[model samples]
Target: FVFADVIGQIVELTPIEVVSANGKETHKLTVELRNEKDERLPMVLWGNFATDVSDAIQGRGENAIICVLRFGKIKVWKYERSVLNAYNVSDVELNPLTPEVEAFASLLSSVYIVMCTIAAIESDMGCYYLSCKVCSKKVLNVPNDNIDEQGDEDEMGFHYYCVKCKVKNPRLMPRYKLHLVVLDNPGNSKFLLFDAIAMQILNRPCNELTGSNFEEMQDPEDILLALKDLV
Candidate 1:
């Protein structure tokens, strides 16, 4: 009958969509929240509460979503696992000016970066992908019968929440998904790059890699292009 506050990082979140319940269609959301100890659990947000979470900064188009849900109801799935079901009384914040976020920031900025040169396209793979424009993570696709004015099956109507940025986006975009082989001289390693870096290397979007441009070697030319600059 009641719920309390909990702080955790979102692990995975599905797209918000309208579902047929009883005799009507209604909006709903499911999110996986993880805590400092790496424990994760799912939380469901319903109606406007779900809508509000989807529209939040962390739930918006930010490439990643990272935030907290301070209150809600605890829901049990299958009478075994318990999940938090957010209600109208629940309050959600993105990058809230709280001690949890502050601690996360310090750990986030502590990562180190290294420089290396492209040696070879050892394992050239996917050149394009559809991902959350904000967090750049893969967006989940859930089918719903809810039709839009365009009768488009309302595919674009799904709001996908990102755990890294704690935001949600209604749409997905084509992005680069590349794996490059690099070396810092005498040492070789596999390096992965995402949309932003790939765009910079090719000076083109992921959609440009047409079948006509693809070679037997599988995007060797794309590798050549990256060599022009230190990628």
Candidate 2:
């Protein structure tokens, strides 16, 4: 089957890796694209095209991208259904010029990007969850002392482990997690601001805030004062 053009959102992206193809090893980047109706199709890109697309998104630190692919041939696996393969002739267009993509911009324009004044900060919800910097995952604190052969006494040492990354580290980082009641001309509503926004509001990093006087961070007034200009 040949599709001259296809439009979809990248629902899943796989890391570029060397895989066995036709009994030979080659780098492959596989992605699952979803249409507006939620139908998904797997597409494979080889070598440079695969590495470029994968690196471009990773460098920008974006989760995913919607794109349009022009011309591809369908290939069927032994046990699986058909999937699309891109060759030298195929062209990829990001945020392509199409009615489907234009609709997204239209929706964005229709919605207002208003900044609301925070009426209340729910600091009680915890300013942040203790996380590991490398993985951005909640870390589990544990005693650093190694258990003896006979499960003996507790010694002086402590560290944290990141379950998501499946690694142990000597320290954990703090990332802000806040819930606030924000006021706008429309009215007041609760808004949850995660780590990124909170960092901008405080003008301090996750490490600094957690390392020094952590208790002072509990006061919402200090945070609101710093956010006066932003909101």
lDDT, each prediction: 0.59, 0.62
TM-score of each predicted structure versus truth: 0.45, 0.43
Candidate topping TM-score? 1
Identify the leading candidate in terms of lDDT.
2
What is candidate 2's TM-score against the reference? 0.43
Q: How much is 231 displaced in model 2, in angstroms?
A: 11
Per-residue error at 175 for model 2, in Å?
1.2
Candidate 1: what lDDT? 0.59
What tens digits encode model 2's per-residue C-alpha lDDT throughout 1-231? 656566667656644555567887656778887765566688778766676666565454543467677787666577554445466777876666778787743443232376777787776565566766775645655565665433222332545566446687624667767777789887787766667767877777756745644232545555634444444
* RMSD (Å) of each candidate, 1 decimal: 9.7, 11.4
Q: Per-residue alpha-carbon lDDT of model 1 for 124-156, expressed as tens digits? A: 565454556665555544444454545343656
